[model samples]
Target: TALAENHPNLLASRHQLAGAYLADEKAIVILKKVVEMYETLPEDHPGRLALQHVLACVNLRDGEPERAVAILEVVVRNAEALPEDRLNRLVSQDELARAYLNAGQVKKAVAMLEDVVRIRKAQPEDDMNRLSSQHYLACAYLAENVVEMMAKVVQKGPRRLVS
Candidate 1:
């Protein structure tokens, strides 16, 4: 709370506190406040996008896949509009794929993951993004047949795979 007061303008600080709260039972309350703060920002503001992404994650964590899919759809659209090389764009796409899977949209998730895989593969061979994207793509494929295959599932990460 002190950080929130001391750095009222620092969205990241508030986001950190919100994330901490989101890890526990108070997630609903904390996420609501953070989402509200983010919604007040301009559409193009990075903080708004980031907050929307966080809300999407919270929605998923709360077992509300439909809500997550809804939020991720907007995030994915905005991310796709950015340059192809932008890390946030790729990360958003990946997250959207995860949301789709969580929402039981397997084919849709596969399509998005395939797109990410293709894009990453087009980058330099040494790029970690290429490697990790390939891995996630594979995992997504496995996820589609998980019921039959009986395999463990892997979730997407929020961090950029490449530097």
Candidate 2:
């Protein structure tokens, strides 16, 4: 139904629907359309980032981390420069870090995740987000064999329950 019309309001919803389509054929088609719509929008338009994020997720799920990384790099770079959207910038950075990890760019992933941890920590003390980002950063450090960084992050997080 979405493929038949280019309704601006439906673009976001279609992107969500695309995620449920396990078959790449349908998903890619819908995603491509969404990307096209986003491309036509202003460069700073939030919808562009949202569509790009969705496309990156699809790429990652399809075993195309490199492609995901490409999309997220732009998203992260632009989001980071937007001082008004600090939270969006941090979230985009977090996603880009995950994409970097998937692409085996461990060093870049660690750096980006570190920034996320720092930014989250500076917020009004949202323990859950702080701990989640810290945990992810710690895991990234572990993957890179950087025990020191992993130890620092783990120490800052809440103690785990011993079974």
Q: Give all candidates' CA lDDT scores.
A: 0.76, 0.78
Regions of candidate 2 where Cα sits further than 4 Å from its true position: 1-6, 22-25, 123-126, 146-163
* TM-score list, all predictions: 0.74, 0.75
Residue 45 accuracy (lDDT) in model 1: 68
Over 61-128, each residue of candidate 2 has an lDDT whose tens digit, in order, gives 78899999999898876776687327677767777888888888988999988878877777666576
lDDT of 1 by residue, 1-163 (tens): 4455324466676677778888786766766676676776666667778888888888888889899899888887777778886888888888888888788787788898898887787688888877777776777788778744433222333343333
Among these predictions, the greatest lDDT belongs to: 2
Task: Give residue 131's error in model 1 in angstroms.
Answer: 3.5
lDDT of 2 at 136: 79
The 10-residue segment with the lowest total lDDT in model 2: 1-10
Report the lDDT of model 1 for residue 85: 66
